[model samples]
Target: MQVSDYTIGIDFGSDSVRALIVDVTTGEEIATGVSYYPRWKKQQYCDAAANRFRQHPLDYTESMTDAVRQAVAEAPDGVADRVIALAVDTTGSTPVAVDESGTPLALLDRFSENPNAMFVLWKDHTAIGEAAEINAACRAAVTDYTKYEGGIYSSEWFWAKALHVMRDDDAVAKAAYSWVEHCDWIPFLLSGGAQVKNMKRSRCAAGHKALWHPEWGGLPPEEFLTGLDPVLAGMRDRLFDETYTSDEVAGNLTGEWADRLGLPAGIPISVGAFDAHMGAVGGEIEPFHLSKVMGTSTCDMLVVPAGHEGAGAQVKGICGQVDGSVIPGMMGMEAGQSAFGDVYAWFARLVAWPLENVLAKNTSLDEATRTKLIEETRSAIIPQLSEAAEALPISDDILALDWFNGRRTPDADQSLKGAIMGLNLGSDAPRVFRALVESTCYGARRIVERFIEEGIPVEGLIGLGGVAKKSPFIMQTMADVMDRPIRIARSEQTCALGAAMFAAVSAGKYSDVSAAMEKMGGGFDAEYQPDAKRAAVYEGLYQRYLRLGEAIEKETHEDRDDAAAPKPDKRSVAEPSESELL
Candidate 1:
């Protein structure tokens, strides 16, 4: 009998941490455990109105400990003893300020409650101004630092968020020695790394979010950074130059972490990476097949052979194209929408306002009944809305823009806002919801079009994550809008599974990621083909969406110009104008 080796994959998401144990021989998932972040569940250290989202380091440590131990306990007896290695995937560029010892500032007593000292969530947009300045500075510089990063830097990325916090918080800025991405920091913590400088940075995180490129010798020059802002003077030096792929071993698990996870000590741990990148691999990604991780946001990944034609093309307005970021020896390209499933969630919340506000205030019903009613309604909103929206006719009478969280791809512009047009009293909830759904699909199509226009063909799409698996309505709509078929991965936790595959490779259970993927991949379970009639109708509606988007974008720029224009002196405005004087 061939003995089996097991590996664990830990995925750190925005709200929770999950641990997935897999049998390497058969790619069978043995056990899974999940733990939500307590502080984050209560909405701590976040300001939605200001677009600031922070996560405490304790939340990560506590939740990870709970999740891993739970998974170990749930597995068949002695399976935990057979576990060979572990890997991790996390959202990025979720980075936090760290001291020289590689400890997150939030872990220290004085900075424990400071939001600026915590890990800045990927969706946070507090650094819009800082991002713009970086873009401007890059454009004016001798070397364009953002060329590989789609020629645009986003507020959601590392430098912009770091600069924003440094400028905003004096205590954090003064005490911080360096910044570390959530993906990089987690592995270092598990491996018991001693110093910030010794942490092995992820190529995916560095290339995609931190503007680290080999062309300019990894990270923009110190002179360039200081020129952008004096606060960023020594940042380049404090950060790393070399980066490692997820398949490589970062280090061995320390005795402390091994005890906490209930696993053997000194087992190899693979380098960490972003969730979507690893999720693509778990979904059995192929050359030219776009892997769309459709969660709160959509991260679309495409891997092409390193020697493929146009592989060296610098596709504009994408997230980034990094060598070995997804699969080693392949050119991994990324693009995404800042809002995907979040669009539906936002609409549901908007529609549920009266129920939560008014019904909760009513004294007519008991507290228990009211609570149950609210919970049921909130849960049913999306499914109910989806069904009704599916029944509505496809038309361009109403259109919406999927920029509620700002545009993230085909040109990242966080300043843009979402809008719905042609709405009247007659337009009902279902109708509005339908338009919103179509808007997201249209946004997706735009990304596909951008890739094609840039000479990178998207042969098909592999869908993974909550929106892809749960909502057939949205998936079908996406197919119709793109006029292409969509394949949904079989695994519920593709991100975690991908991490396990990497862990297997690092532990010598497999020679490389491709071999591990071939052995462990969960094939497609469902496929959505574009309906002929709907596809044709959506073609016209999609054009309307583009027109509306153009108008909105133009208006947005004009508004910004108006805002930036120096206000006319009050005295001068009150007095006669030049024409009147003449």
Candidate 2:
């Protein structure tokens, strides 16, 4: 009898951490465990209204340890010892300020309870003003730092978030020596909590979000950063100059971490990356296929061979395209919407407002009864809305824009707001919900259109994450709206499996990512084919969506061209003296 080697994949999500144990030879998931962050679950250090969110380092350490230990313990006997490698994937651009000794400020005794010192989550939008400033400076420079970053800098990305937090809290700014992204920090922690200088940063995070590109050297020039803010000046030297992809090893797991998880010591740990990029590999992405990892937001990942049309092309209105970011030696292109399931969650909250605020005080129910009723109502809201909306007949008059979290693609603009144009007094929850669903699908369609317009043809789409697996109605609607077939990955944890594949490569189990993917890849579970009739109907509605969006864009802001063509050089086109921010 032959024993197979196993690898562990740890995925650090917004609310929880999940550990997956897999058989490297067969791609069989042997055991899995998940643990939600206790503090985050209680809504600590977050203000949704202000768009400020922070996560404590303890939450990450504790949840990851518990999840991994539980997963390894549940596997068959001796499987833990057979684990040869480990890898991690987490949310990107989620950077936290660190002290001189490479400890997160929030984890230090002096700043234990300070939210500003905690990890600034990717969804935080408090840095919008700072982002605009950076964009203005970049536009004025001889070389635009944002050329590869969708020609726009966003508040949700790295530099903007760090600058905002630094300016807001003097203590954090004074104490901080450098910043580190959550993805890079976790791997370093497992490798014995090394200093920032010794930490290996992720190419996926640095290239896509931090304006790190090969053409201008590693990071944006120090002079360019200084032009935006003196506070950001000289910080680049503290940060990394080079980055590594997931296919390489970050380091070996420390003895402490190995003993804590009951796994063998000194196993190779592959470099970390943003979850969606790794998930793309697990979805079996090809040259033209778009992989949509739809959850709260959606990250659409595309990869082409090194010299394909999109490889080094500076496509407008998408995320940065980085070489070797996803699969080694392939060019990785990313585009996404800032809101997907978030739109539904917003509507659900609106529906429950009356029950929570008004009904809870009703004399008809006691505290316990009221709490139970609210819980039940919350659970049933989305499903009930989905059913009622599906029952309603489709109409063009009921239309919406899925920009509740702001638009992230077809040009990155955070000032845009969501709108519903065809609401009447009779437009109840179900009718409006149906329109909202259509709106999200339309948003997705816009991204595909942008890709095609830019000469990057999307041959097909494969869906992963919670939204794809649980919501058949949404998947079918996406198919109809896009007029394309959508396939869902067989693995529920595609992101984790992708990390495992990278781990296998780092451990020398396979020659490369493609080779590992061939053996350990999880195939498609289901395919949703487009309905011709619905597709035709959606075509008309999509045009209406475009017109409404254009009108909204014109009415909402001054004349800063969103559709401007890329300038060959700064000298060729004159720079605007005024800021374009709304």
TM-scores across all candidates?
A: 0.98, 0.94
Local accuracy of candidate 1 as per-residue lDDT tens digits, 1-582: 777889999999888999999999889999999999999999899999999999999999999999999999999998999999999999998999999999999999999999999999999999999999999999999899999999999999999999999999988998889999999998999999989999999999999999999999999999998997798878788899999999999999999888988999999999999999999998999999999999999999999998898679999999999999999889999999999889999999999998889998889999999999999999999999999999988867789999999999999999999999998889999999999999999999999999999999999899999899999999999998999999999999999999999999999989988999999998889999999998998888888898999999999999998998998777755688889889
Compare the candidates by TM-score and give the number of the best one: 1
Tens digit per residue, CA lDDT, model 2, 1-582? 988999999998888999999999999999998999999999899998888889999999999999998998799999999999999999877999997557899998999999999999888888988888989988888989898888998988999998998899989988889999999998888888657888898999999999998888899888888777788777888988899999898889999988888889999999999999999988888788999999888999988897665776788989888888899899888999988999999999999999889988898888899999999999999999988888877787689999888889979888788899988888899988889999999999999998889888899999999889988989999999999999999999999999999999999999999999999998998999999999999999999999999988877665444334454555424554446332
lDDT of each: 0.94, 0.90
- After superposing candidate 1 on the true structure, give the runs of residues whose Cα lies further than 4 Å from its correct spot: 573-582
- Which of the numbered candidates is closest to the native, going by highest lDDT? 1
Model 1: ten consecutive residues of lowest lDDT: 568-577
Clash pairs for candidate 1: none
Q: Which ranges in model 2 have alpha carbons more than 4 Å from their true place?
A: 362-369, 558-582
